[model samples]
Target: MENNFAENISPAFSSIYEEYETLSKENYCDIYRRNTIRKHVETYLNPKDTILEINAGSGIDAVYFAKAGYNVLATDIADSAGIYIKNKIKTEGLKNLEFQKCSFTDLSSIENKKFNHIFSNYGGLNCTNNLEEIFSQFNDLLHPKGFVSLVIMPKFYPWEMATFLKGNKNAFRRWKKNGVLANVNNHLIPTFYHSPKQIKRAMGNDFKAVSIKNIGTFYPSLHYNSLHKHPKTINFLMHLDSWINGKSIIPKGIGDYFIITFQKNT
Candidate 1:
């Protein structure tokens, strides 16, 4: 959480780091991410398990895990977000969480020898085009049979496609390619979208897929701030998402984002 850490990050993400929480502060979509992702993480992790979290934005998920009795090393590329997380950890008097300023591509800075889980939430993994190299490091950082949980933006999503019906064809097919330049915080950065199969192949045979579940399939895009304004309607969609959440691969892979759990076997 050093003030100078911003010098190391790309401009697009630096701008995002500035507006990260402000965009989602009072938004229910943020709550939905917290509830949905936390449930999946808790289901696989036991109390006191150690986790190395990549792109641990503002430490929201890290705090949740600490309160649940897990030790976490929260790593991020942006110092601004890391500083915010550090303050919260201090205010809450949580000793189980530590913040480190580092990108997902480089974990060499981390001193931790091994961890029970290696995690990346939301679309952090999408920011890079080199999954094979990144996943290789993730596997090496874990203990044998340790779990890696990733919440990824799939190559195809209904929400992106929905833009097509609104006459925004370019926006609709942006993710169809393996890589795209996305405008974030008014700066362009390269982003890549990978399908579940592509990710499994990238991870190679050292890991086995445990489970995949749909998230935000029916809950509307997190960008839709008006969801909270219609409590009854949003609640209905939330229930529908819960019912069909893990029922099939079609829904699981086709949602806004999908959770894929893998256990290292080597």
Candidate 2:
């Protein structure tokens, strides 16, 4: 087995990850947030291309892509994630989606398969220390002109720093090179924060940056559970984001999460 830079994942914890994440899930306005990301992701994806989704939590995004008429192979380190997608596949009779229990760094099981796109969402790769190792593999896995879209946390997000006002000392946790341990379901998981520059270098010279858009920026955070209650405010932010998102509108290092896309240099 290769060294898993995502130091804390294990079979025992895998079964409970979804449950552990419920607390955050309940606090997050996911529907609105997901639609926002999906809108951006689909713009870069070709419906005919097979997508390999890493860190596929609950296989939600995979199912979404499949339903939209794309072929998808959803892979996750957690075995439970496989179960969720399998159940969804069976229930929906989805023919275009496949599931596998796999880790991002160790995708040897599917080495023979090549894809036109790669995706990972919700900062799942943040658990690993080896950003370069992961990105380097994309060149081999993707065809020429292939795209990779990742929604991951950057080394800095302005809103999180506001935690200092709430008297939280670990406001700048992402700044730590060694990473910090996040408590989930009484389990401490190691989480790392990466910057766009670091990811670009890790992607080597084979990949070119396509676009970087702010995932959660300004006014209300994605984690703000009650966003639905304030539809007007959220709408304004969405409207504002539309203008500044993909056109290099939002400044780097300012979003709670960022959707960074890269394309293989043909």
Candidate 3:
């Protein structure tokens, strides 16, 4: 991880970045989500392919993929990430993993880098509305027939609606047009929800859809983290989640988040 790579990082989201692992680290729902997302990516691309990962928070996924035999360049806007990422590299002795403090919108720092696979997880791209500007850069970075996998929130989620019924006021925040202000540790960060269609359209003719899979559909939200205490209930929910985890009859863009994969096309 480079020391001076991240520049102009906002003070608002900076604390959220530093406290991210603390927030989700104990959430079992998040643990399941990460493993499921990794399985989908592994199924889509080979370990031999190098990956350029944007918004690589805490570098957990980067380290996981690197240990699984993939070379990964993990980029994040959080300078605080350097400390955690560096510690992981030193302790894990990871040679295939590299870290850069880069934002997806401005790839100029890594513009010369080419990769067979690009990954951004957990709605990091939702922070900005300039996706067209972002996807245009993908044309230059991805090899022909290479893959891009993103995990993004949709306009609507059934489970979120269920949470709404239970009095979670922010449940329907995705409906906001200009985007919603995500209250992270009392700091407001703007977030936008995007559908799979919107993402593919922005990706343009240079990419073709490969798969759309449910992530956390039928699985209880981490907000319901207490459900983890009940083994029988957890087993039943996990079974339903497994049934809907991969490609299914369920339409796209209807999960807590969906992992959509696209391949670069000539």
Give the TM-score comparing model 1 with the true structure, all chains together: 0.89
lDDT of 2: 0.77
Clash count of each predicted structure? 0, 0, 0
Worst 10 residues of 1 by lDDT: 1-10
Misplaced by over 4 Å in model 3 are 1-27, 245-247
**Each model's TM-score, in the order given?**
0.89, 0.87, 0.89
C-alpha-based local distance difference test score of model 3: 0.78
lDDT of each: 0.77, 0.77, 0.78
lDDT of 3 by residue, 1-266 (tens): 01111223344455666455764576556777788899899987775689999888778789889999898989887766666787788899999998887778678679567898999998888777778898888878887788999989888787777777789998788878878766655656667889888998998988899888877777776657577777577667766877865447688888788888988886
Could you tell me which 10 consecutive residues in candidate 2 have the lowest summed lDDT? Answer: 1-10
RMSD of each: 3.7, 3.2, 4.0
Q: Alpha carbon lDDT of residue 131, candidate 3?
A: 83
Candidate order by TM-score, decreasing, is 3, 1, 2
